[model samples]
Target: MEVIVDPINSAVETLMSGTNTLFILLGAIMVLFMHAGFAFLEVGTVRHKNQVNALVKIITDFGISTIAYFFIGYWVAYGATFFSGAAELTQNNGYDLVKFFFLLTFAAAIPAIVSGGIAERAKFNPFLIASFFIVALVYPFFEGMIWNGNFGYQAWLEATFGAAFHDFAGSIVVHAVGGWVAFAAVYLLGSRQGRFRNNKLVAFAPSNIPFLALGAWILTVGWFGFNVMSAQTIDAISGLVAVNSLMAMVGGTLVALMVGKNDPGFIHNGPLAGLVAVCAGSDIMHPIGALLTGGIAGALFVFVFTWAQNNLKSFDDVLGVWPLHGLCGLWGGLAAGIFGTTTFGGLGGVSFLAQLVGSLTGVAIATLGGFIVYGAVKQISGLRLEPEDEFQGADLAIHKIAASSMDD
Candidate 1:
């Protein structure tokens, strides 16, 4: 029988696919914009002398990340390549291409997170090289393992545990990985000059509170897209994710306000801590569960940041990425197991054992990969600015211009 294709049905399918492509493209843009937040946050935190370097590092890292992920990382993660001709690539409304764009934003965030920790003192070239390797190889390895189910890791989790590991929007995959990787780089880079003197902590006040607050606000706004758009298709979109993100954000903010005693930096970062925690389970979680998860993350950031600053004499994490992203991301992973279960008023498909194993595994891979990458780069090209150069600040030393021309 000669069958006539339905033009209306074909049109609807095209529209739907086109809509989803637009949706993810917007998500890619939003997350891409969050790099500005990362820049400003680091700019505000580091001394004014390094402000120019902060801005340059984030944008440059993003550029390098795009190149690396496009050339290599995308294939590493999903076994897909863009080497196909434009005619083939334009198929399916170019949804696959936009999907790659969306995920590349996530992969780029690793270097952005590490940039904060190593700000002011790191050599620009070596860090970029390390970031290149990380985005091209290290990050995508774990990313494929979890998100694409490569290497049978997810299968192993399901077979061994009651449920497979769950990270709806990459609490462990992105944030935690970035955080722990930052920790390794920070450790290897050592404390910034005079961050400690004779076993005494020296407080470095933020250069610009307004800029810092602006960064936080930008990140908070962009995060809704980050969480909600992980669905990647219009049909899979969930209002529940949006509401959960909102609740978790407020929960984190209030808790940070209380626990941090209204410190502006802590207050601003609170919502981020919450958002990081909630990303793992926003789809399945009750709003209240998300709130508590975020609240705990906020408090954890404040406490761990304070404790690490005071106790870890050799470890100087300038923006506290370790606590905010790494530890809180880890907590979010575990919290998914707790809050994303029927017992906790969630949809129920998470295993605490799986979470524990997966979270720690991410931490391990990121940390080890960070050390190996940074260590090799450090030995070969060196990681830090020279003492005289560091003292001169990255702005003058590397960029040869201060944040303000008047300073010249």
Candidate 2:
């Protein structure tokens, strides 16, 4: 018997697939644009002398990351590849291709986060190599386990805790991993010269408030796509995700303003901290729960950033990413359990134990991966610049140019 394909039904399916493909493609573009925010954020925070390097690193890492992800990372994570002929691979209106483009943006973010932590000191080539290794090897391994169930990690968690580990977006997957790796890089790279002089911490003012704020705003706008588009289909889109993100942003801003005493940097970054925390739970939590989660994250960033800079002093993380992305990503993971449960007036079906274990696993993997990768890179090619080079600043020493001619 020959099976007949219905033309009407086939046409409807094609149209729907095309629409979904377009929707996700737009989302990929928005998230890709977030790299500009990351670049500007680092540019504004680092001194004028290092600003060009900051701009260069974000795009360069993104370039390296695309290659790594295309060749290895996507296969490692999803067990899929584009090795097929173009005609064969173009099935489904090339939705899978656009999907890969979207996820690569998230992968590239790992290096963007680290660039801020090690700004003004790290060797550019070594750092790019490190980013390549991370996107190609480290990130996709864990990402495979979490997002693709490559290791049966999700199955094991579901058996033990009555639920699979839930990260609707990537609180632990992207932000936390980036943050912890940043910690290791910052640790190994050490503080900039004169950052801790005579056992007293010295302050480095932001190069430009306007640029920093621009970055924060860009990221804030892009994040709606980052969160909403995680649904990955027009059929699955929800107003709830958008509203939760908005509420969390508002909650974080107000709290950071109060806690930071009107500091412009903190004020701008506060919404980011909130957005970071809400990523894991935005799909499940009520707007009220999201508001609470954002508030706590804002407070946490302010408190921890102050402590890390003024007191800890082991490493100088210029953007405080360890707190902003690392700690808040951890909080986001766990908050998905707390705020995503019926106990917190959320949509429920999450397990606290699962969230705890999954979040911890992400941290452990990030920390250990950071040590191994950065350690090897340091030994092989050297990670930091020479003292003299450091004194001259990254833009001039590495890029052979200044952010502005006025500085020369």
Whole-model Cα lDDT per candidate? 0.94, 0.93
TM-score of each candidate structure, all chains considered together:
0.98, 0.98
For residues 249-365, write the lDDT of model 2, one tens digit per residue.
888898999999999999998999999999999999999999999999999999999988998777789899999999999999999999999988999999999999999999999
lDDT (C-alpha) at residue 141 in model 1: 97
lDDT of 1 by residue, 69-123 (tens): 9999999999999998999999999999999999999999999999988888999
Stretches of candidate 2 exceeding 4 Å from the true structure? 1-5
Q: Count the backbone clashes (under 3 Å) in each candidate.
A: 0, 0
What's model 1's lDDT at 310? 94
lDDT of 2 at 293: 92
Model 2 Cα shift for residue 245 (angstroms) = 0.9
The residue ranges of model 1 lying beyond 4 angstroms of the native Cα positions read: 1-5
RMSD of each: 1.4, 1.8
Best by lDDT: 1
